[model samples]
Target: MDTLSLTLRQRKLLHILQSHENLITGSELASQLNATARTIRSDIAAINLELKPFNAKIDSIRSKGYFFTAENGDKIRELNRINTAFFTRDDRIRYLAFQLCLTDTPINVYDLEDEMFISHTTLENDIHTLKLLYMLKSPFINITNQHSMLSFEPDERKRRHILTSLIHRHWNYNSRENAIYENEYVSEEILDQMIDIVSQCLHKHRLRMEDTNIVWLNIACTIMYERLSSGYMLPQASPVSKPDASALAASNEILATMERLFSISIPPQEYDEIYLLISSAHILDPSKITLANTCRIFDASVLDMAAEYMELLQEFYHLDFSTDEDFYLTLLQYIRFILAPVHRFSTQENPSISKSHLITELELAWAFQSIALKHAGYYLNEEELLHLAYCISGALEFHFELHPEYKLSTVICCHEHMTVAWSIKRKLLGAYEKYLKVTALIPVNQAKNYDFSDTDLILLTVHKKISDETLGKIIEISPYISPNDIRKLEIYLQSQKVSFLYRNTGSVRSFFETAYWHEDYEFDNIFSAVETLGSEFVDKGIAGREYLSALLQRESLCSNAYCSGLLFQFAMTPAKQTQLSFTVLPRRMNWRNHKIRVIVTAAFTAADRTLVFKLKHFFYRLNKQCDITNAVYSKDELLQLLTAQPDAHI
Candidate 1:
């Protein structure tokens, strides 16, 4: 369908045509669009091109003005794609947030803690910090759980950021600034210091310096190098080569079926180059490992250490890294990421011949993981982590906005009966002044009933249904116009491409099947300070408010993370902090019109406002986690599934 390029007026007419299942008159469309009936008729003539593909036509009987003239699965799919691609910013963020595809977990938390005597709080804070930082630095992002886990999305914009960071950032830090050396060697002092730290830590069961770990120490070097020296950036795919052409061709093939199935075309060649680079850059080719036969990068010890590193990483993230095929790609990517700088540092004619120490270091990480995986660190995976990084970067890149092709006009169609469309239009254009050259708005109903003339795209509410008649009408008059639901419109604009840009939560909900649910069921989880096996207060000196306060303080200092829907409000028994404790209250709730029975948890401090974080996080998660949203929302079962006795409290 030619729906990707329609103007505001034509689109508005299409909207009106579709509003009625029966034939719609041009006069009705003119009334809805607030334009002259003569102008509307001219627009009808202008839109015949859109109806060509389906072998359809738009009709205009003296009184009957214009309506779609075709019917088929092709048209349906075209409407479906248009329906699916219009997601808001929160939608994308939420989409990424709730996708918990981590193959490793728990251990990541522990390792981060083990490094600095960090309470779970600090580790969580670090994760949050990384998220904010990453969002600030890139365009493609994946922030899972708002603040708990992270990942970088496979977006074209992200590829650009990666290229820039690589080209402008350094990769080796254990060197004297600007002091070039032969064969990737660092300053003599740096080498000596590293050797000394390793020797001391290995010799002394523990190091004497401030609490830290090999990973932290290693990070220091990796970050320092990237900062000190510019890394390499791949050539823009536009300056095509054999590689670029090949990547483009491959991407075209992949997109072919999706396009064929839906009758929707993606945003253009930009993605073709990006998909190619992503497929190849991540060692995605099964054959990348085959290159290994040419070089023994490591002996058995290296493999052994990798096993250990994998284990340690598993603990650090409280997730397992080896349980699924997805993790294999993720794992390979991690290994490649961890060793890239080192590999690059090698100056030998056959640098690949000398990449063994990096292998050893990886093995060391696995050594920690090997120490019995924990339930917590069994699900962390690299892509998800990168996803987190991706969101941080994209959100942060808010300051940089410009699109090379395709100018846009935005419409804000909310449920509000009143018109806020003008404000929405202004804000959207202002937000992307770099790319948005024009703007306008109409009452949502009007916008829905009539699209903009040359309105190329739109934003609408999530999961809203696009009926066949309505869609067909739009296609007939303005198949080039893209519809975006207002609720998530802000987010939809930032997406690299839009096959379909509207999400009406009402109708879209059916795409996802419910895993589990209850209409009015309730469950309670109780925790009490009263003791029976032992006296209530045995001078453990950690009972009541004081204990909770200390824990909370530590959490604040570090940042605590809980699985799923929870934010521990431990202040109910604290002193250093105000009285607060977080608990999940699973109850029936509706978000974006989708009903969900969830735990509406809150935290309390004497002075802190009710724990609004729960609501905030929930809102954020809702938009990003379309696929996993149902699952997370469905886990509110109150069954006492375990038989273990309660823990002893003093």
Candidate 2:
């Protein structure tokens, strides 16, 4: 029987049906194979035709779906084993990619087509897909097909990196048992030995690693062993000076064990690469390790970069992070390994960290990326940015913990009984005790009479029509706070916190009223738009003559375009007064890569942090709620949108 006659999906369907002794529903089979019922029926029909000669068939009952009934079941199992199909396009591409990376000589296209049981066109398409994947995954490595001969870049380090990534990707999707059986490069025994060695070495050095990190290290070492045994060695490069003592010691022991077990001579360059990999893992506890030792591992320039990043963050967030030595050391260590010249480690995606919780940190990470590009000339990817966000998140927690005075002073007013007001206060204190300090509990009827001058916020538990003058400080909440109420409270607290930090006095509507909007405005480019709007602010005595130059300088460093608006701020120093100018272009114009119709240029004093925070939320709403491409918002409409309750928690 020709096992190649059945498609990959068909073979998988056959395997599923063969595993079941009784009847299996077509829907069950469809779900298992991720196919439709009709497709499963078609696949069953195709499989039966292939099995007709062997007297094996998948029969169907009237209503109970299908069952596998074969005259000789062993023949069908043999056929299924022989086919061993690559199920999806991704699977095929991964297989071909590994084949290309492992081979020293170029593989003929026709030879690959025959081996994979695919047509010439299919193989060509797979090659095209592989090129794109490699381009994104490892830009340094190039895949070429000259004269229908397929090969990749000859750099052993890149090849090994790609190989390790592919292995990890596969392991992520499949079970460990399946991964053990499917992995073709490293034997089970050798992988086990490598894992054992890595675990013991890390334990001996008091270096802690996550279980997944242990697997990753073992896989990397196993790949190194295989590559070395095949006579491929990493090219010698400048060694990392003053590598982490703990990681270096651990890498040395791991290498020694592998050398003895595999009977291969691993070079010093490989040890350096392993040291970098371990350092990049960031398993060293900052509390356990001293700053001096950690500082010794990084270059002076990297330490300077870390300091610059912290300063930039402080300036942007209006929060002081100078006293957090642990935060500084963590950022320094990450920057050191990330900026390494050789064997730069790619951060893996951490599924456990919630991106929503890291919104503030993510913003900080974005700013960090801008500065990193300006100074270091490297664009951080999403995963790398996420890693930075986690670090920043920890620092922010520590900062808030150390400085409880930063918390907002609050008074809870309720129209209900005294018990209800106390209940509300309990919930608020339970949830945000760190963020809020409840100053007083007042009844709704007596709320207007009491003095709230010292309180930063007034949380009313009942509906009360607040006067426009005090609306900025009042937020209505339910007696039993809902999640939505919590989110609104969070934003309010963040805005209020920034307001307190900057000593902001203006209302949200007043800030919006100060904005100058130009309808049907025309500009050839972003520079012209900035000049026209910035000069208007200068003419209004809201900004200095250096405002335009500062905007241009910031543009040169990083484009200010975000969402459907170009936000240009002259934050060199606090302005005497705040001014905002907005232009609604008749048509969308290209600003960097963003298609923006709204040009917003603002000159904000250092005390306008609340306005800056609100403006950010306003633009976010402007993008999500309004169709900037076609809809033209009037001044009142824009003001309304700006003052609307923000849905996202700051």
Candidate 3:
């Protein structure tokens, strides 16, 4: 019997029927195979047809489901033994990536097709997908196809890093023991030995690393060891020099222990690679080291970079981190690790801080990433940015603790009576005493006489518009203070408190006017849209000629594509004046993975920093309140959407 005649999934279906004594339902088979019941039914029908020639069939009893009945049990057993598990497209891609990483010679496309039990077209499509998604994006490796043969030219150290990442992607980081047993590249014994060696070396060096970090290091070491054992040695030219003495010592000890246990002579380049890994590991015992000592451990360039980042962060967040030595050291250490010779993939997941809680910090982090790319030729990934945001969030908490005077000074004005004003103030104070300090209570007629200089917000019960000077601070609310009023007040208070950048700046609507709105604007990509908008700004005397270049540079660093088909592009330098150009696309176009329909090009001078900050908060509110995906089409419609009442549920 030709066992290979059946498809992988069909063979698996036959095997399942053979293994079961009692009948199994289609739903049960589908659940086990991660397929729909309909798919299972179709597979069973095809399998029965294939089994007819061998006197074997999957017979179904009414309501009892399927059972295997074979005249020749030996032949059916042979078929079951020969069956291989079905590999999904993603599984095939990973397998192909590993094959490319491990193989030295060019791989023949036909050979791969035969080995994976796929057709030539399937193999080609898989390779194409791999190249487009992974290989083309990789900085350390390149794929070349010549005469139907595929060759991967990769840096040896980077190849090991990529291999470890591939393995890490599949294995559960939470279950260290399970990861060892489940890993396919290295044996469980080898992984165990590697972990023991790393743990012991870290202990010997008094370096208390996180469990996840330890697992990451162990996986990386095991990959290096496996590769070295297979006769693939790191080139001597790739060794990074001037490693920290403690990290180098730990690296040497770990490598020496591995050599003795495995009887393999490790090279110096391998030691340097391990040293790099150790230096990058997040040490939990940093509290033991003083800030001065930590400063001495890193290069002056790294320290300067860290200081530059802090300065930029302070400018954006309006919080001085210079006095916070702990924060400085933490940021310094993180910068040092990320800017190391080899990029270390962080095992940490997205931050535990809620998106709403850390909006300011995340914004600061995003801006930090943009500048980091310009200064240092490296782009921080989303995970790295979120991790940095978490760090910033802690610093913010500390900053707020030290400075309690940053609370918003609020006032209440009621049209009904002075008693009504007091009642509104009482309700607001009851809900947000920590964030708001109710300074005054005035009737609607007496509101104009009140001095609003020290006030951050003015909650009015009447529909009367305030003076143009204090228009931005006014929030119309009901005399009874409804839930919608509370929601609006909460948003305003949170935005004002978190974003210290808000300094009595004019309203976001002030910067955006009907004149700046471009209806039915069309562009090919994000870059083109930014360039065209920037050019318009220059033509209108809102920005300088160099503003276009600045806008392009900022956009090049990282995409500013937000949710709901919106793209926010900014200039690197300040413009002549503050202006926001809103371009509503007639049709949504692709900006990387996002479909961008609205393009907001901001041209702000140094004086408009506070206004820009407030604009960001407004956008955040707009995203939460409006259905930007479907409703926004025209400029008037968008303006109306922005001017609409705040959602009561929010």
Candidate 4:
């Protein structure tokens, strides 16, 4: 029996039918598939005709719509198998690119047409279209011998990148239920093993890494290792010196594991190369980077670039990287990839510009490119600039994540229907899961009955007549959320000036301890000053040794130093008791590559923990002013600055 053919549309119809066992009306099917009722009737007739040899039939009910009935389930299964024969044009093009990338020799166009089940004219058209793409212009794709033959011109590094991107795209598409294709150059088992090795190494080194980044690193390593095993090695532009003892050890461990898995011996220089790759990918111990160690791995130019980038960021946005050791190290590592001789090519188009809050992101990207040109003597392409914007977005998310206690409380009010309110609430939760907490959902009629005292904003689905005070707090929004609405809300949320999440009812002055105060102290480094402050707190019996440990741990993640020579430090969790310490060092001391002279350390009990973040925000505002940081010298001067916010209502 001949297997029945199906177009993609008919296959989609079959999928929708299989999902719903009950009867559906012709109009409902057409609505679901975005077609007319007449078209749906014709498709049903075609479906039933194909099912005639099988056990299945598309049964039509007069009013209730349509349903599929299977007289013999085995025959229905055969029908499905035949529908799987249909392949997309995109699938064929990707397969052709994959084959071209993997093959060492040139491919005949006619042979490809036969393999892909396409006519010679269609194949030629596909090739012509592909050649016009920006990705194929590079050292990767090449057309030779009068455009009749095609070959992948490999620069080992570029090929590895292209191969990894293709593998990831394929895996992401089919990972849910489909089996890995056998024709892939690198098998699933090998990729999985490589991921395992990288995972193990990261765990052993106590490095903090995100899972997405780990997967990317794994793919990159696997492709690079595969290329090297196949005797394709990109020439090293610069010979690598022996790596840092720690990085070398980690790299050697990875090499040993890879050798066992692939049964291939790697050269010694590759050890350092792998270490460089790992570090460049931002998979490293955050605390391990210090002034002494940073110089060893990075050149003077890289450090200068990192500092310049931070300065530019501060100028563009009020972003403070003076004490962000992790960000500095990340930028340092990232610059290597940017400055490397190997040019990166992307087959995919930049689609991030279409996302919500794109205006703000693009503004940031433009600032980034402008700064890069000014400071680093380099300019980023649209794709690269978008990537930088992503990095900035990630950093912003991390900033809020680091302070999860500070969520913007929101209340949704909808008088139309409960479903409308529920739908809006669901969207709010999904969209702002990290930065917002939807406190309550109430109908507009019953809004007065609920407590909205704690809520930051009252979101209304429609215009409402309310008191002037209530109107000030209310923001009218669409019942169906739009991207522009989200952008406006995000901007409004950031601009909101509110009290701390964990504020104490007592005044800020009440949290201070007299014994913890010091004036005109002299210290050349941050470590000695921290130790001295810890001793004072311990002797006063206000905080334990754990408090100092937490403070040091926070510093290790990033410097607590901000611009204009002020340092604000706090722990993630509150201290054993509430004690506020003030230390004033008049001498400019080098701290985390920044000059710092004044330090404020607040140790708050969990009960008064809200004060920590409020104080941090207070310092952030203070850091923006040169007058406060540069002019304040005496305890009274600093006290006046801190207490000036009497209306803060702490």
Clashing pairs in 4: 24-65, 24-66, 25-65, 323-559, 502-610
Which model, 3 or 4, shows the larger lDDT?
3
Better of 2 and 3 by TM-score: 3
Which residue pairs collide in model 2, if any?
none
User: lDDT tens digits, residues 1-650, model 1?
Assistant: 34523444564455445334577766446545544467787877765566566565567666544666556533522332221121222222222222212122322445434544546765565555446435543332554543333444544344344323321222222322211111122243543443344334333432222112232233233322232333322234453333434434444453443345335444344344434332333222344443243134323433444466556445532224444433333344444433321111111111111111111121123223222134123322222233323322332233233233434554445434333444444655665654454444444355546645445444443335343323311211111122223323433333312111111112212211221223343432211211110111113332444444433342332222222222222222222222221112345332212233342222223333222222232323332433222343333322221011111100
TM-score of each: 0.23, 0.60, 0.67, 0.47
In the order shown, the candidates' Cα RMSDs to the true structure are 26.7, 11.1, 11.5, 21.0
Comparing 1 and 3 on lDDT, the stronger one? 3
Candidate 1 local lDDT, residue 173: 28
Q: Could you give candidate 4's per-residue lDDT for residues 500-574 as a string of tens digits?
A: 333444556565434266676887556777777766766777778777776665453333553445676665344
Instruction: List per-prediction Cα lDDT, in the order shown.
Output: 0.34, 0.68, 0.70, 0.60
Per-residue lDDT, model 1, residue 491, is 35
Between the candidate structures 1 and 4, which one is better when assessed by TM-score? Answer: 4
Question: Which ranking of candidates, highest lDDT first?
Answer: 3, 2, 4, 1
The C-alpha stretches of model 4 lying farther than 4 A from their native spots are: 1-86, 119-125, 132-141, 145-147, 154-157, 170-183, 201-239, 242-247, 257-262, 265-276, 287-299, 310-350, 370-378, 381-384, 394-650
Q: lDDT, candidate 2, residue 479?
A: 89
In candidate 4, position 348 carries an lDDT of: 27
Q: Which ten residues in a row have the lowest lDDT in candidate 1?
A: 641-650
Which sequence of candidate numbers ranks them by TM-score, best first? 3, 2, 4, 1
Q: Candidate 2 lDDT, tens digit per residue, 193-225?
A: 887788789889988765555666778898998
lDDT of 1: 0.34
